[model samples]
Target: MDVGVILLTLVCYALACLLWWQLHTPVFLLCLLSGHVGALASPLWVLLYGVTYRADLGVWFDVLGQPVYSSVVIASAWFYPLPALIILYLHRVRWLGARYTIALLTFLVMAIYHFIIETIGLGLNIWSYDAAPLLPFGLSHGLISTALAATISMVLLYTVLVVQRFSLISMVLSLVPATLVFSLMIQGVLGAPFWVSLRFAESQSWVLIIGMLSTLGLLGWAVHIIAWGMDHMNWELV
Candidate 1:
């Protein structure tokens, strides 16, 4: 067994369980996972970038008379976005059936989460925000990051729920793609490039268009496979 993958699977399951309990539905799991994925990956990106790029800077920059770019400053970012997502997801998933309302609410909560993380990030001097302040809600990048991820997650979850009711096996496999994405995210946790932002930019119609098509293709295939099992294998819902 791949222990690492197994552990991630367990984590995803636990997250699904938690989200379902609060929301009384499983329709928000995708967004919840995405939000957590972003939060987890962001700090890693900051740390990797710090080590990889710190040498480029001439010397230590001081903030509040403290050298702000130290290793702790570089490393502390790992804790944000992740916890914030879990907390916000738990609160927001309960509104899953609200459609546009849920989307807006999730976006609002995630925006605040991103804002706080970026604000703290700037304060620690781990990274500089283009916004030029350690205040949350003042950064467009922050809002865009959280809002976009949340939106995608909601769509994934809603589609999954509408197409097939969750069962033990479906629930297990439902997370495979997200698990893979999370693993890739973990592997690339190092500082985000403009490309990462570009890939996630909420306004990128092309990406959204591609994502919708890809999601439909993938989901269609998955439902077909599930139907095969239901028809031929005598699979029963748990």
Candidate 2:
């Protein structure tokens, strides 16, 4: 019963609903959809790191009597929607473009945001990232991993919205399992190295370090892909 997190989640959901009602736009709906997807998909990352790299949630409620934390699950509802908010804000300001500037800026913002939240979670005993290993500045592997997930997902979501132009069909499609599928795919792909190293390597000391570097390299590649995709996309907003 992490009261603070629960309250924050409620506020986020309420604000999103209010905005959607007032604006009647697809972006807010996208945020809400992303939140739902995050709630479902967020725990998978924890499950990965928990088994391999040693992350843990505090004594919160579990899913299906499993070790999953309810706090972790609910916190994701707020976390995942943030990228949609970023995309919407960037699009509104005409700052959304196919360039390194937009992609890098988005990545930095997401990374900082993820790092801060993870640090706070660690401080609050909501989770632990110290068991296996840590990055510099006492950062957790989850920081880069999640930021990459969000940034890549944001870019892909933008591409989808641009292609579909928020048509009624597109709206319906984007607001459901499609978002979940992509979210999972992005996370799974980006997180594979770390999981593999920790899962299979008898001595994960060097392998984990290599895995971390590989994950960073993949993140850079993903960012580059975002820029390339943005360049190819036509600016057709319906």
Candidate 3:
């Protein structure tokens, strides 16, 4: 199972590299960069959520190693970049035009993406959700936080790449902010309520429930704000 996880991560990197080699576009370059950034920034997710890593799966940099909640492993890197690539592709091609539509689709698609990834990770014993999960599939606030982060990140990407038409250098630099956006979203904006509840109300199920609900509400509002910005914001700023 550990080998499977390793192979999967390698395969993803290979695919991303292959795609970049073929297209040689800024979009694909950003995708590859996203993987590297995600690798470094992923520990923020671990810090905000309840997750435990398998002893055998392997760790690259152990940010936190408490027995109950472990830091991210090497396999964590591949997950977010793929979704970033996909969401950016959808935006680049203008597949979904309406802000709300794109927002909803992005959220659902990222959710499903993480769902499949988490399923494999959980099935293979690479990682386990030890926190208060609202669902059996371990689709807890922790997982939802990443999806929401992806969604928010997409909005920023669209603004920079699509709306503002920034130069290649600017686009490259945008990667840092893009990466930080995920960390901010997970650690502060959307993950805070659930994380606070997780810490203080471990025994109270209802408190966790409220926290999840509040997080969901914030997610919806975020989507709305992204959509509204796209619809009405003056894109004239240089």
Candidate 4:
């Protein structure tokens, strides 16, 4: 990557900060970041799927349908989601009903935006398509993945923010850890693994599987808890 491209991206993000002000604070920015990180993680699936295939997957490139640029962006997208999830999880614990619903809804909303971008990627050949049915929300490879991510982010964030009554400063501070954790996740997803656990997890293979399942469960529980709170408490959406 050239310094110019990096500089340009930084500017884009700075614009994104401005855009956030025009939008809904860090929440909107988190949605965009999640989408970008997810795209970057495409290489992870490629490596696993490529090796299992009998033929060569070919060099990762932009034109050849495996562009390194897009891959990095996707992995970058993955970084924002965890904090969103954490935020949502907290909301569910404190008060479920509508606040949790808002959190849940925002997560899904973010995923939808992410899916639109991913759909564009598939068309651009940023990654190889291996759909058995090729339907959205089926194999979870295309736009469906986008929807899922957005939904999860919103729901989770809603719960966390409402439950914790987080101040802007704390929410912003949380992003630091989120970025660190996800940067590592993205690295692992891209075969780099800045941390040993990611590399070791790759070796075990089941580690990633367990991690993903646990994430799913935690997310689901978050939604469920919010439901419980909603029923028990008379929380209404503002």
lDDT of each: 0.40, 0.60, 0.57, 0.44
Query: 99-165 in candidate 2: lDDT tens per residue?
Result: 5476567666666776776666666666565554455445566666566656645654555446334
Model 2 steric clash pairs: none
At residue 137, what lDDT does model 4 achieve?
A: 25
Tens-digit lDDT track for model 3 on 1-238?
5566568767776765776566454555564455455555455555666665676644555444433221334344445556656655554465544455655666577667766766666776766666544542345543664556556455544544452255667767765446556656655667677777776564677777777768777777776777666544323321
Which is superior by TM-score, 2 or 3?
2
lDDT string, candidate 4, 132-218, tens digits: 222222344453344334444444343334433456676545543444344333334322221222234435655544544444454
RMSD to true structure for each model, in Å: 13.0, 4.0, 4.7, 9.8
Residue pairs with colliding backbones in model 3 are none
Angstrom error at residue 138, model 3: 10
Q: Give the runs in model 1 whose Cα sits over 4 Å from its true position.
A: 1-96, 126-140, 152-164, 179-238
Better by lDDT, candidate 4 or 2: 2
The predicted structure with the larger TM-score, 1 or 3, is 3
Over 4 Å off, model 2? 51-65, 93-98, 133-139, 149-153, 156-164, 200-204
lDDT of 3: 0.57
Per-candidate TM equals: 0.36, 0.76, 0.72, 0.42
Best by TM-score: 2
